[model samples]
Target: MQKFQELSQTELESLYHDLLGKYKNFQEKKLKLDMSRGKPAADQFEISMGILDEVNSKSSCLASDGMDCRNYGDFDGIPECKAIFCDMLEVDPEEIFIFGNSSLSIMYDAIGKMMLHGVRPGAKPWSRCEKRKFLCPVPGYDRHFSITECFGFEMIPIEMTPDGPDMDTVERLVASDPDIKGIWCVPKYSNPQGITYSDETVRRFAQMKTAADDFIIMWDNAYAIHDLYPDQKVPLLNILEECKKAGDPTRVMIFASTSKISFAGAGIGVFACAEEMMARMKKLLAFQTIGFDKLNMLRHARFFKNYEGLLKHMEKHAELLRPKFKTVLDAFHSQLDGKGIADWIEPLGGYFISLNVMDQCAKRVVQLCKEAGVILTAAGASFPLGKDPRDRNIRIAPTYPTIEELQQAVSLLCIVIQLAAAEKLLQISPEK
Candidate 1:
């Protein structure tokens, strides 16, 4: 196929005319859809209908450990639940600590606690210090950015390559800058882009020597089990294990949850870290609450016997999610396959399709879709402080929509792309 740059003016004009005619036909369809957030569909949640049976009116409120789940007492969460999440997160049961319903809240608390009363891990509290910066990778989770944004930390946005974040830049920014307190990472099936960190990237992360002892790697493995392709899900190098191999187990804070596995707003969150880190984390947790919901923890523990059981259940999840992913993927390639106006990656697994339009056209593309009644993730959501440097990347979530809805929605999305790209290209053409 000829490259867009090599195309003659006549060829370009002809191509534009064809796409414009296609876009006009799309306007007649007048589809209404949303590809905004990575939410599980109602059918997916049916798998957890058994949760109602995990505990019942006839069931005992007593936990396996002897703690009454009815009342608060387990300051660190029920041990059984920690064991279950330990398997879910692929860490030692002893290394895992179950938290509240939402991991995002716990993440905020961790940073907030440090702000108010320095990191009690024998480091300077952030309140008294002036230099506190965070490393943020572009095309990342927006909510993750929101968490860092709240603290007023200087966010350094790193460009995300196919393999992962630019590690050379990461090494320099992390090692040389003492002010670089932390870096947010979603290594496995990363948000938006759905690109997993390679083993080499993990090795680089493990070998990183931060200037600050308290420097943390907030690893939010949110979509670890939401693999759309069960067989092809790229397993992470286990940051905790890798850290130990590098003699830095305390550096990475591993966060995972059943948010997508079970229910979105009601699932449990876990934080797996080295013992030393946990001690500091618990020190901060002491002021928050005496304990989290142990009953919910017990329910999850009994529902998933161990790691194998959890993996088996995730397979069922993939069955429901596969069609949704294929619907959008097929539509994108079908309509935009040879178009030089845009490009995207075919992710092996995960809940999103990251589409990149021609330079500086993300906002226009999204607006075009919205006008046709399909909402998308915000235009610049994939960058630090919500500003994509290229202004072209867009994240498409296919999980919540049904297969039919996804097909129609993706079709409309193709219209948005074609219209936006044509207008932008025409502006640069000599014919304009």
Candidate 2:
């Protein structure tokens, strides 16, 4: 609930006084806590240890195709593993290609390949473009930004509407600007903000008529299977199906992984695109290695057993996760609601929360918390080039810490915000 607009000056003073007291107490406690990074908490990892036993040396390591799992041959991935990843993406088996552990690594490799050889989702090698540009929706995944920047592409900032990137800007820039090469999107439970792209956003993305025929859309579906609330799962229109419906199978390259559901580093990665794109990708990937370890693929497939198994594992994650989520949310609500000093999103399932304080105070607020023994993701990391244009967004990761640690951390955060905001206001006030 929010207050109505007409409060007397005395009333404002009383409110600020209460807020100040709360801030001072948080400062006095001086607790050292961290809830900054999105890596899973130790407990979240423990429950999935059975994945290690899913396969063993004594087990029959043979695949459904009669190929030995221990040996390497299927560069694109074993058929069963591809099918599991495909079901997660809601795509056909032919559209999927499984890779090594990290999807981030796969994504990085794609960019590297593009820069050296310039393949844009299997289109004409973008090596032809003298000046390449990429579209980034603000408050986006910093790693994605870093990937594009590493290739020396210009990162153009686009506003993130609640639905998705402002398509009006996206369509115009991509349509008229040949230099604009691609856009990075986390369509489901997007990294820091956890927003799912609306159907219209998906349709518009599929329908973009780019000036550069080689323009690509990099769609990361990292949280496609990570749901905090099973019944409340966020629905995203399948990009593969959407593109096919629009009759443009070549428009996107989709990426996904089993990092959260199982042992992250040991889990499998996946990428899927149209038949044409896959053919082109095969050409590029063939240069790297002759064959990938199909045993791990076999392991993940045997571990999950099927799509239903993946869903079951994700539910166990939710059980461990829900309490941690509640601690942070409850702390924020109990301590700072309507304080006029900060605002944060209560994401339904993602690993991070986007916090907005007064513009320009984010850096100092984060610094203050660090001094008080709480570590946070570096300020300005939610946008391109480690910069939040408004200087107000702070990403809080609650999943990696215990509830007690997160509780203490959120308490410290509330204090840091208040003191920093008050100092800022006082420095600017003329009547003080």
Candidate 3:
């Protein structure tokens, strides 16, 4: 349990030799494991197989309001699906708009809309602006950064505190600039770190002022109902309500999907915002398609009769995912705890464990793991523009692998961490 820095040169050198030997043993095993993405395991999917049976040829593909789902019409969303989201997202049904299977796709379209048209009616389109920028919290989702990057928006990396993004800086930056148009947020069970925004943070987000009238908060609440521990669920204050109370109702746009709950590609994605924004969103979306897959939406609504049913279904998912998370965390404690080489957050509900290795060691550790047959999310992937300024954070995804497989991967991962740390230490030590 001693910190690596506390060891003497002689002890460090000996430890380095031991770690090198462990690394070689891993090399000999030639294991091929991938811990790159936070994908649900096969066992998790098995419990939700009944969803596919929701709409069969014998079943009536009709919405509760008697709109036939097999045909077209519900462009915004069927009332049934929106009502489900209203309960899940803690917003009114009128505030929600359902989209295709991927929330990421909806996000992309939203950004595209902002670039092509303004955020809302009568505002200037971002394309006409001389400069455009987006705030991206560090160790954040790469896909969110990618959407901004693709549109050539200047991405300003914001430091993430345990509570949330550094709001003092966010407030200052937004107050001073009209060019800073938006911020990408994953409020509950955030992508890589799994830190939910504190209530104060959400309130500040709602009340923060910007020079630009069109300033928006892209709230991707992907894990709103994804509780690993069903009994001790964390509650998130609805940002839409906060914004409305703050008299900035048009400031936040919420996104969510059931990709992890049921099926990845076949799930329903929903978009929620103020009434003004939703109206603009609907008008823009009408130009793109006649309507989304209402049958899929009906299937989801039927499978999970109410919000309670969705939560109950997620319990089965938790049964499969909990062990995998524990296996990795237990391995970290057993093998790397108090070593001074790495640190990580124990997430409550999200799919990843954010591990921070010594500066300059993450890339080396990832390379060493890959060479030893374990694939990991690339170093610096959690940051904007694929660059982690410190090059220290690594996202650990445990849900996709079985417990045994996860144990093996974590075992090798620990070895690589030690090997990389020792190598870096030895290079700097005067005794070398």
Candidate 4:
């Protein structure tokens, strides 16, 4: 039960050997387990199978505004679809633009549009900025970092506290640097770590002054309704409303999708901002396509009739996800709790569990797990350009595997972690 740091060189060596033996045993089992990405298991998909029947050929294809969904021309999306997001995200119908299955695609297009045409018609395009920069919170979403990297933006790493990104740093950097044009935020049940932004953090983001007039807050509220505990839901302050109150109605572009709720490949994505910004985006979108899939939007609208219905559907997801999360946490508690080598977060509603192993040992642990036939997200993947400066953080995604497979995988993972940590400590021990 002693902490790894409390053990002497001989004791550490012994512990290391024991863990090595266990790891080799796991290798002999030839397990094929993957925890690399936060994908929903097959059983979770079954919960939303009824959505396929929500919109069949026999069903009326008419939207709430009497526009036939089977045809093109509903550019901003059908009224019923917009209304669902308006209620869910607490924005007006005018502010919401429903899109295809992926919110990530919408985000990429948004950035690309700003790069080519600037935030408005006459403003200087971000691509022309002398030194374009973006604020990326550390241990953040990799895809968010990848987007900024793709645009050739200088990604500044902002340390994330339990409340949110360090606001003092965010405020100071943003207010002083004209080149700092935007920030990526996952305010509720944040990716990897489930830390929700405090009300104060949200307010600071809203009221903070930026040197760039076109400063943007890419508020990707992907997990806004993905609560593992339905009765004890975490509230995220509406960034759009907060910006409006701060007299910056167009400061943020909010995004969400029903990818996880209904069907990952067929669900609807939404983007919301001020009415003026919506007009600009729609103008640009006109060149791209006449419309997204209205039938899919209509299907989602009919499936989850309202925000309340959406919540009920997410509760079902929570039911399936809860055990997966619990299994990983329980294993950590039983096997790695008192070990000084690792620490992790117990998230309420996010798809990932963030684990920090001993400094400089994360890659080794991942390598060991891989050798033992277990796959994990690369050690530094959560950071910009795939580099975790401390080299400690690891993202654990448990939702994709069956409970039995997860049990075997996590057991091997813990042994590998202990082995890696022990190896690191032994290398530094004076008695060695």
Per-model C-alpha RMSD: 2.3, 2.8, 1.7, 1.9
The C-alpha TM-scores of every prediction are: 0.94, 0.93, 0.98, 0.98
Q: Provide the overall lDDT of each model, using Cα atoms, as 2-decimal numbers.
A: 0.81, 0.81, 0.90, 0.91
Residues 45-91, model 1: lDDT tens digits: 89987875887777887777798888988777787777777766777
Comparing 1 and 4 on TM-score, the stronger one: 4
Clash totals in order: 1, 1, 0, 0
- Compose the digit string of candidate 3's lDDT tens values, residues 187-288: 888888888999999999999989889998999999988888988788888898899999999999899999998899889999999888888888898899
Worst 10 residues of 2 by lDDT: 1-10
Q: Whole-model lDDT, candidate 3?
A: 0.90
**1-432: candidate 2 lDDT, tens digit per residue:** 333123455654565577667756766777767767788877877877776776797888887777887886777888888877878888887788888888999898877777777664445555566788999997899999999988888999888777889999999999899889889998887878878899999999988789977777899998897889999998899777788888878878899887877877778889999988888788889988877768888878888888988899899999999998888778778766876767777777777777888778898888878877889998889788997877888988888888878878887787677667765655534123
Model 4 clash count equals 0
What is the TM-score (0 to 1) of candidate 1?
0.94
Poorest stretch of ten by lDDT in candidate 3: 423-432
